[model samples]
Target chain A: MTGADRPGEFELIARVFAPLAGEGAFGLVDDAAVLTPPPGEDLVLTKDAVVAGVHFFPDDPWDAVAQKALRVNLSDLAAKGARPLGYLLGLGLPDGWRTEDAEALGRGLALDQDAYGLRLLGGDTVRSPERLMLSVTVFGAVPAGRMARRGGATPRDVIVVTGTIGDAALGLKLRLDAGLSGRLGLADADRDHLLDRYLLPRPRSAVAGAVLAHAGGAMDVSDGLVGDLAKMAAASGVAIRLDASRVPLSDAARAAIAADPALLRTALGGGDDYEIAVALDEDDCDAFVDACRDAGVAATPIGRAEAGRGVTVVGTDGAVMDLGAGSYAHF
Target chain B: MTGADRPGEFELIARVFAPLAGEGAFGLVDDAAVLTPPPGEDLVLTKDAVVAGVHFFPDDPWDAVAQKALRVNLSDLAAKGARPLGYLLGLGLPDGWRTEDAEALGRGLALDQDAYGLRLLGGDTVRSPERLMLSVTVFGAVPAGRMARRGGATPRDVIVVTGTIGDAALGLKLRLDAGLSGRLGLADADRDHLLDRYLLPRPRSAVAGAVLAHAGGAMDVSDGLVGDLAKMAAASGVAIRLDASRVPLSDAARAAIAADPALLRTALGGGDDYEIAVALDEDDCDAFVDACRDAGVAATPIGRAEAGRGVTVVGTDGAVMDLGAGSYAHF
Candidate 1:
């Protein structure tokens, strides 16, 4: 289809997005919105775009796609020790988009708004020729100078991660190679768990307060464990020594890894696992873990940061392992 | 190309966009950045996306396309009576994208960042697969409760506009139909002026203070005068009577319109003119105009708002003109 051939972007936004707008949004009627700051709070901002067939399957449920987009951005906030305020959504409809699809997308956002205690702000919708794309810019707020920054990781800092790793990666493999699920002899529950994790990330938002309280450095692992840790290490001007054996794994991921040891590389390097990774002083590691546990998020000691640069991955053999092609290259 | 097939996005960002990063961006390494609210000011937020082939020709200059994307968002903030602080950019590169093209796009943004006195905060760059798309979210600062909202227009308010009305519309036609320029007997300078206006918007950012001080309602005219006025009228619960004969036009637009009277319809109803349109009390109108003039931007009288509904356009013949299509409609 040619450009601007959709029915009406304005009407869709009015019907589907206006009701979810923040009080400051003026129901999306004004040229722009006035965002009055809550006194003494600093705002946090991040933008991540998901293009069709790149970040997700085209046939994925619209609501789930919406939730995934929202959750991934919130995952960043959670790692930064911020809580949600609102978000602006940029949705580009592919040709042949239907009104019901828009409605379903709106339903997903409305449900998340209630669940997350944030409101929709405002955004734009345009025509993307071949595929649907969603670009989300989420706003979050934290107390002054309290955000857990990536550069703060120092020598002797213990690395911590929330929830299990590798399920999303394995699930993605399952998604791409349909026969892989059966080849791995995966159980029905195992298959579902991995698929759920890949399709929808469980952002560790509940642990935001804990990160602010106890962690010195933090970030969400959207680009696999090994590569994301390497990024944090490089950013912090420190070295990360990650013990693959200590890396937490779910039953589903463990089952698949045990059946096929080669899949471990995929699990460790493949991305889309939206979990919080934190670096803290040795004295605060246990407390940070306990704090996250209090939030019902599993926190595990995965590595340590040293005064050097770059990242080192240790195999179960207690020796350095070469993690060729560290993470999913798509991002 | 398949999903995630592009070269490293992280490296590209660190090399190009990182240099333009705001102080809080942490060189684009942190999961998110902190935005400290300027003392005692309300923040204004606006997002507008331009898709290739939809917003402009795919082969448009990368720098001009980048500038257009940035200017459009800034235009909204200007109309809202806010001054720029910084912005986030979401760029989607098409298949077979080159590194040189990315550098050229960066050069464009770099030039505008200097021109507009704003910093690049943080944003996302993804593979769009087929077409390029740029989404910009701009932030501006306005003193508390000083925003010029579209809903604040009142009956008896005089409408004022900054800069000429419809040169960009005619310019777009000139761009699309090269032969039309010859038929219209257009001067080279006139043709260049129209195309320049269409390709790169000159946002009336200098008049922000004037808008805040004198206007009751305001918006940028990206969607033609007639349609935009109608929107303001509806939002403000008033009626707008536009004096079409008084609408300011560039020499080129006037020449073209005089040559073909039918082109008047395209001029009035077509859009892409990024001038500020403001509604002020009759007494404030002249002062607002004078203030804009002092900023080196011309402000012209367009019409008046009345206690009624919708918008009416009166031609030089002193009769209501039927604007068959209220706007360019592509937006």
Candidate 2:
């Protein structure tokens, strides 16, 4: 049947979301998400939505769409130094969407929820016109005093980040413009790295607690390192300076940049890395790095927070260099 | 600009949802809905979604759409004997939706949130293709011992309902098929009464509290009186028998039904009236009626919860008739 003939809200919800049960918790049929934060832990809740076209390709695979929707929200919780608890989903599907597609998307969500140790609580479903939208509200918890915010950095704080940057930006560029693919003369290795970064981003939650426990301020790099760090600096009332040479890049990214230095510009400005950016005092940086190593997560020192406004990236010779404008802007 | 040319996710959210200020104590900028259930009170939360074409006409007025979306959710909270506190809304607008239309819808939501003393906590906005979808999660609080559940009704409980029923169904029928307009030949008063029920529905939150405080079990009449009452009986593991003659109707309803007796079926099976259907002990019925009288809300004894499995409607002559089919089914 066509989407217009699809089942109504209740039936569609029962078919799509009801089967993804939670582990070690209250029933999903309950009126609200019945999770109770563990003692000495504070609840951390964040919500985000992925719109058709804006957040994903209209023709993006249903499984990827579902996973991305859940993952993006999880990344927010991770940035806050919280462990996953459960989530509520609100899905708006067009009349033309197939039941199989919806089911596939649900399975993807179920997979991530199970993988992350989060239960699928409850959600609402409705019919729309053409595009599909998913709104996810995640609940997590962090030990008291361990939750991270972007406003806690001090002038002497050392800046650190998890994982490499800019691969996702390259991935998006490749996906959107075929001309870029031809220009880079990309091999399968470079193409795969970019694709993986764009499609599946890993949220760095394990080291988040350690960073928040020891560091002064932190945020996730959603909108490119430069733009997001700029936000963190503004929120923390400090200036930040990045050591351009220390910024980590995957071997594939380095190779791509070698082919064309402009690729470095993309890595610096392109976002969706889901990496945590933290600021800690110089004396605490070593301990924080040790904590990350103990957690089996990578941590790299890339910059330092200083007393000023705006962010500046300095070369090895201490000369200020311009990182091309970072991240996508709507307006 | 065409929706295809619209900016990315961050831009869309900033334009549509982020800047809209709400009146909650913590407002829309928080991590989670901060609800302080009054001391000695119980918290109740319910979520529901209204899909275009499924729950309403695609062309329904924006304010009416907002009203239906909010009232339906509030109806659920009211049935739990909770006073409305606030709601979190997740809205999905079609790609072609006008910005002004969205703002008008937002104003409608703001108006209701203010009227009900519920703040719009936080919500997500996404772009969809065909229809506009609204998913609302409402929270409220009731006296600890007075919250109602459908499973609490025992056999032999007296069934009661507040307010007149079926006007919404007739209104919808008239709106969809103008041929029915001439058949009923409704006067301006009759037309206005039916239309009012469609445009604006009041959740019986106050009446619900009185019932929950005294009645054995309760639910709001959403899927028509006959269908919803049957659901209550099913949940309570009891049967129901309605006194058809005692079903209250407005004078306009009576006249319209007289012109087309078939209208009674619509009245009996029509949904979206937002009335409270309650089961109370036989001994408590008089006291309950007195309480409703003091509260200035009408309370009518309509049926009894019996020991059998299905519903039996007793006619004016005391003959048992089968209301074999009644209710508004979305699917």
Candidate 3:
């Protein structure tokens, strides 16, 4: 579990990917992995999968399952402004575990592939019968005319987002309920910063090329935020809404919502938040929250996009309510 | 089991990726997997893993488990000379199975991602309690001065291969001994071409850039041509020998080695045989067997490269015979 202690897959990939820092030139211990682009750019591949009781909770903390499987495949290559470049894992592991719990899940995948300049390049390991499964697959490049997509949102765009959203589904309802940890008396550093944002979720690949140089459609919320903005408003056919008091919480979610307001249903049905939700264009929403307050990150806004389709919301007597649906779907 | 029946995961990705056909440029339903490079070239990557009773046969056949998980990840992007350019799956399933056997294993992974031009892009699916596991990765591009590596073989190279190698380990020991299938008199089209090379092991990515424009070290024969040419003679440190009566066999391996010479020990330790083995340069081994007979394929040569380190077999009175300790290693 995040209590850490397990390291061997090549010494946890030489201490989590031999200290990251690369911008392509290939060479990630041969047999394959070589990228190059970056003088006009193009590439953008992506892949995701993290099952274990269907994605996390097999005692979380193999360094937050190797930083939420390399920040949810670097939030789908930072919703397409790409850049990152380098990744390819597939792990499985299960037979009575331990090879140092797969060397602390390969030193949490070589510390998020050396903190993102990536280059774990190739991978594949097996033996499974239950749980522990990863499957990353990243690679980026961008710049062949700003990437972004989610069927290029429209109906007057605007949604926004970026950081704070249901502290990773209220840190998975405080690790799957003990009656919501004595109904939110949750201290010990606000339950270890909401269990490290549901086990480490960074990937805003640092404002992916200034939201693909402004935004119009993008994604990465890993479900919830009303089921991934109802799958980016049914892949951009359009109709959004929102409001329920402009969402953005976190002062440890208003002290666990003044100690239990049904912890606002884990801030509207929690879901691992790798952030970046975008859509923008209400004149690039105040220059995209003033370029996320001059790149300190945090953006926000929360709703717009209308004209026939799903989402909706409003509340506080301002009519229309029922936003239920949450995340983790399986069927 | 592979006899069909069981589906869902979008009807096994619309029946194995609705008849695939990619090379990227928007396909596998998009949002990544685009690749473009050609007027220059570079991208290359690899990944593998197959597990289920550990790589095949828990009653195999979800279309040869989606064609040996996209032919052992396009045999590591055809041992690195790159070409395919797309792939990324991570299935795991098992639990009240049958959505058309997970759409016959997503129509055997969209018929090997439309027979190798890859493009499946996004992936991940969970739930497992019994067997079935896969984890491909692939990608390719090469050409920045023709890739090819393994520590460039030397000391008089010339080993080669390409096709026919103990019919996928005697079609997985006649698909796990049905009392050695009536004592190996085979036939049923030589037990369905040696159990479809033990369930689909092809990946030669159309002769990976003609084995890096004519070998000097290459790989991809999933362990067994004397242990992947002694890992291409210990990653080109060099010593290989072979000449076991010039390998290349198939009349269903000379009618199962004229009814058992212990089926050439299942073709010297029957591993998958995604073929390709290379080494060449004893003057480009007859122009790499005339560029695999001008691309009609089936190269052969059987072996060479010496000056010492391991792997040995001499016979016809030249003594030194130890064809034992090589293939089948997992621990």
Candidate 4:
């Protein structure tokens, strides 16, 4: 930060963005960046924006907040079966923004850039009078004509999800309710797991190749699983039959659900789970599962597509239930 | 709007972004978009943000706000000689934003889409607790290894600036102080000229080809002419000797300066002049000027690079003058 109460635009680039912007010069202050797309690959572009309190806790660590911003966009890329390339950040700092807050943000971005194998290309930083906001535009590449889409699932497809789904949803619940840890009699590790998952998403980039190879259609579960599945059904003109018992959950989520059975709905309907849910040809289902396993991701078969419309979820009790308005709408 | 107090995100994409996103279906709600660059062209990317009361008047027409947001990035692209291709928008809306504002924003984008030949790839609209802000990430295509840069000038180069300068700076002054119009005795037409230039930027996209063909180095003058010229000199590691009297001024700016001779400083050191300044080989300067003229842009030789550092401004009186800290710095 500048010696003044807050950093100027140039100082903002040199410090808060330097760690992630790269070695030598900060491209953050440059006019523009130029790159050639890899041969025979189409560039995949997606943007996701997060605001203080709306998407994450305003007091959340800037590093994790930076990671959350990156991962949300990365999740979109992975769902499209694209390989990570780079990203541009648009950050809006809150009033009286301090040097430490800015440094922490840059540190968070630097850490995630290493972990996710992408670098900051270029970006813009601005001032916000009230809350902090981050807008991340991630660019990736997929082989020509091979990017997964949301409209290809058919009656011959089997549905599967990568990684546990409900951990983040339950984590969000616990974060919003401070007494939740005690209400559920959770261990410290479980509490941390839930809170961490809610704060930072683990995008399924590892299985992007497998999904590209075998999935007929795919989407990242950012909104509630049931609502997203319903969207998939509508887009593909098919019906999906999901077995709720087959839906994977982290141990922490299971603990929470065990304490309050009603929380199961929250697990199924809450947003921020950056897991890929894909529909594969029945014949390719085993191969896809194996590929994900090799990628060190847990893949569980959860549903099937049929020649009809809408999504159905049968509970552990073998009875159909209403999921309600589960999809997260950001308006 | 989504028939609620405000538009839901899906409805937002469907209505506000439809005109710019295209007709058939809104890609706004889709997972991601993929595009392959044209053969033999490298992608050029840049992002710039505008905020209410900061970049433009908070109550400025949404269309003008949208255009200003867009032109800032387009200016970057043109300075790099990149042809417009597409863009992703990240909008943060203040609490209680209305339907009209959203639609006007889209309409403005749509008008520019047709004028500038770029479509919306995708975007996100999120809620802001306070002010409305827009972050635009624009993408363009430039011929391989041909994107103009900020550094490459030498003692052998002559500096030329495109279009006129200082209109916007004076325009900004008129906007911020309604009484200034009367004090300057600005006619209605003259006042409108300054105010219009401040509210909107006419990016030098027309002469991009000319610049790429004959310029040694280039940068758009967004900050004041003197300050930006100083940056160009610093970046290229060359000293620039500018004849301040040669700096072109529009009719309105000239009229304002004629009324208040002291306002000449504001004209020379004002920001938001979205004009291109280039350093060209003395031998190639005329051809560059000719090419720009043929493309319907005015190009005037304003300065020359010398074997030294920093930037010098020679007044109409033929005396060296300090232009103050003329560059616009965003804190």
Candidate 5:
């Protein structure tokens, strides 16, 4: 059948998205989904969008594209110390989009929904004239008044991060410069690791309870750590001093940076590393680390908040490092 | 300055969207907005998207585009018998978008936020390679277990619709066929009214409380009253018989139809009216109408639900009308 004669919007939704809907979704037929928060809980709301060719290569796998769209929003919830409840997806498909690709996208979303213990709540699908764009509005729940806020960090707070940073940035470099992976003298496995990190983010949701219990301020490190940290510091009305060596890097990133020290700037300032950066009292560091460890997440102390402004990154030689354009801005 | 040198994303958000942020929004700095639903309430969630060429003309006013995006989602909440709490926006701007246009979009959103008693919570902005697109996910609140569902209608329920319909469909015709307006012998004001109805939808949020209290089932008439009624009928397992002569029409629409007798099918089947269509018991119809009247809304009883499936529209001639397509569908 021609595109117009194919399954219409409602039939497509029923065949693809209906099974993903949870109890509150009214099987995707109702105008709106009903969500009853647990007693005394607060709803955490966040929205993120990914467009083909910008957020991901247009040629990327449809499943990975769908996963990346949902995972990025889930990363925000993880930073805010909230557990995933459900998400609403806004999908804009190009005119030539195939039913098989749509099904693949649904399968990708379904996989992540099962993995994250969340369900589709409600959404809208429309036809676009050009590129495919996906927007996800994630709903999460945390105990009342207990969500981590970016403005809560104070002087002397320990700055910590979950998982490695800069892998995605390096992966992006490899994606844009295919030969760079070999130039960095990296193993095949290391190259694959960086590429996977760029393609799919493992949001640190498992440690959200611990982060809520201990973090004073937090945010997901999406737009490169240096810029994101500067934002967090500005929001908290404090200064942050990062030991550049302490910013966790995967083996692939380390190999690339070692091969060309100039690559460190990209590692520090590239975007799409969906790791959680948080600040807490120095005294609570050990407990938070232990908690994250128990939750199967690796937590590392990267720096400290100080009673000043902006961000300062120190090199291994104890000299301040000048990193140009500390973060990614999509202006 | 060129587009690349224009205000960065954060600066743009601060100058425009930050002012629209309400309490618990953390001034748009926090990763997620925290929403505390009033005790014994259920949170309602809905999302809608509009693309540049698909939903609006590429050259449409940025403010009107923004308003259309938010208003469409608000229409969903109104149908579900919920009060607007807040909304999250995901905006994808083309590379050459002007700063002034961005500000205009923000102003448009702010105007509606105030008009609707909602606020901006959180959102993400990204760069699109081609056309501008916007997605809005709205949150509303209703008393626990009181949300209007699509499956609540029963046999013998009276079918009612709030405000006028068909103006938008004709407005769309006027939009696409500029010559058709004069052919329909519409006055300048009537022409403008039809165009405005097509450009901006006034969601029936004013009657939500009354709808929740009195309606058995309801939905906003977005995809034409005929098709949307069929959907409600299928969901509620009841047949809907709509008297075409009783379907409310604005003066502008009436003028157009008077000039063109064949416009009736377009009036009943064209989309984008955004009025609420509801079902209630015949015994409660008068009280519901009075309640809507008190709220400054006009309610019209058009038909009744019966034991069957699908929808049958009776023409002014007392004959069944055959609308080739029951509703507008985006495939």
Candidate 6:
């Protein structure tokens, strides 16, 4: 049974969301939630939304859908070098939604809330006549004037990325075309790994401290690393030179690229890869990498900032590679 | 041209939304916005969502839809006695949406942002395959432990409501069945007045300071006055005695009720009247009303809280009136 089959909106909220409400939520009865500001800290706010058939497969499990809705915003907070506080959820469910779906979504939120040390603040649930849409507004806190910014990079800054990239993009391709896995000669485990990466993102929150301490600029790579790095470079009035061969890829993405060199474009230009990309002074790069390693996060040097404009990717042949349609665009 | 006719998402944000970005928004380029904490204050958060065909007519103007989406959340902040700070918007538009629609939505948001003394902090826009959906998360600030709450009412507290009730409900009826206006013997101007109230709410934000200073408990009447009062009574563990004849009604609503006595139930039991319902000590009632009158706001006393449970409406004949389906339920 889904929440649609359960009862009215208020009852559904009590059953499915009240358990996740934090102390500030007033058991979801109050019109608004209150958050006592963390002493001497600035508040960081970010909002991300996902729509059915647009951001996820229509048949994706409710739990994974809910997790993605939250993790995407968490990735933003992580990139900002802020600690999680809580979040407000706005859900528009299509008519006749299942009770089981709401329960699964609640459980998924609980799983992540525990892992991230956050809680549900308050939210509004409404009926949508069309597709399901979920929007999450997350709050975090950081020392005043110290949050990581995207426009602080300068020439000679080392471009570093946490964890492997391109896996989720490749995963999306495989999910769209199952035959691609066999075409790439991927093993079963490798196929599962790619699919898992697409289904759920592991936000690079563990290395946030290191980024805030040592990096000059940072952002989450949700819309293709190449495009996002280009944006960062443009915002900071600098250029970036990336070594295409040095761009981190999982074993499955590597196998796919080896089978079809054109797949490399998909790996580099596809979005939904929730990795943290940062730029720092060359001297601070090693210390940041060491700190990430100490925190059990993989840190890789993929590029460097330069005194120019836009992003240039040098292929293995030592020539600039032209990336058509440089990023994933929703519009 | 609508935003769908526009080139890309980033360009859309830059052209349509960047101008509305607040000082803390970083031009909508950064992953998250940073807000400096107000000195010695707690942060208040509220979220509300509106969907096409559910919350408003599918053909409603983009600007009105946008205004309703934001103002609904603002109404919540007003009920909580929090001063507006900023808001994040999440919009989902169907493919091929026109550039004119996008521009109209932006204009609408700017109008309300300026009116409410707030700014756009950050937001996300994505494509939806079906109906348009909008979600807004608003933030505000209030002195520590001084925000109005819903569960603070006690016996002998007077129930006061801002503005008139049931105008929106009657307006909705007129909109749905144009012939109803003639049946209710409404004047041309009265019909337009009712329709306007239904289309746009005048949130009682101006009286927020007075509410915080005088009211023991408060909530916005978005879900019908009688039902919402019942909820407050339940939450505060007190009984409410309301004089049904004393419930404030707009001139248009009163005219309709005079033509058809049955319409009185519609006025008292209908929803979407964004008036603030507050509870205060009887002694403070006169002063609160005086303050509101001084501020050019209409406020009226309608009932009183008692040491009991549930809500009882005493009709003009001195007998409890039974209200069937006391509130609107989305589910």
Top candidate when judged by DockQ against the true structure: 5
Candidates ranked, most accurate by TM-score first: 5, 6, 1, 4, 2, 3
Give lDDT tens digits, candidate 6, residues B200-230: 9889898888899899999999988889999
lDDT of 4 by residue, A1-331 (tens): 3356666877678766665664212355457877666899988888889999899998898888988999999999999899888888888877777788888888888887888788888888777767788999898899987889888789968999999988888888888889989978999999999888999999999999998999999999999899998888887889999999999999988888998998889888888899999998889999999999999999999999999999888999999978887888875
Regions more than 4 Å wrong, model 6? A1-5, B1-5
TM-score of chain A of 5: 0.98
lDDT string for model 4 (B1-331, tens) is: 2446666877677767855674212355558877667899988888888988778888998888998999999999999888899898888887777788888888889889888988898888787757788999998898887888888688869999999999999999998898998999889999999899999999999988998898888989998999888888888889999998999999888899989998889988899999999998999999999999999999999999999998899999999988888888867
Predicted candidate 3 versus true structure: per-residue lDDT over B1-331, tens digit per residue = 4325545444455455545536553434434665657768876767776877778877776878878887777776676668786666767677666766666776776666667766666566666657677777766788775678765777768787877887888888788776675677677898788877877777677777678777877877776778667766766677988777777878887788878785775686668777877787887788877776776778888778877776676643566667786575543
Candidate 2 C-alpha error for residue B243, in Å:
3.6
Error of 1 at B177 (Å): 1.0
Candidate 4's displacement at residue A250, Å, is 0.7
The sequence of per-residue lDDT tens digits that candidate 1 reaches over residues B127-227 is: 78889899899989999878889988899999999999889889999999989999999899998999999999999899999999999999989888898
Between prediction 1 and prediction 3, which has the larger TM-score?
1
Supply candidate 1's per-residue lDDT for A130.
82
B32 Cα displacement, candidate 3 (Å) = 7.5
Candidate 4: clashing pairs of residues: none
For every model in order, what is the iRMS? Answer: 2.3, 4.2, 9.8, 1.7, 1.1, 1.6
What lDDT score is found at residue A206 in candidate 3? 77
TM-scores for all candidates?
A: 0.97, 0.84, 0.38, 0.96, 0.98, 0.98
lDDT of 2 at B282: 93
Error of 1 at B106 (Å): 1.1
* Candidate numbers, best DockQ first, in rank order: 5, 6, 4, 1, 2, 3
Which regions of candidate 1 are displaced past 4 Å?
A1-7, B1-7, B328-331
Q: Point out where model 5 deviates above 4 Å.
A: none
Error of 5 at A20 (Å): 0.4
Q: How close is candidate 6 to the true structure, as a TM-score?
A: 0.98
Residue-pair clashes per prediction, in order, are 0, 8, 22, 0, 1, 15
Superposed on all Cα atoms, the candidates' RMSDs to the truth, in angstroms, are 2.1, 4.3, 20.2, 2.1, 1.3, 1.5
Off-target runs (Cα >4 Å) in candidate 4 are: A1-7, A16-19, A22-29, B1-6, B22-26
DockQ for every prediction shown: 0.66, 0.31, 0.22, 0.70, 0.85, 0.78
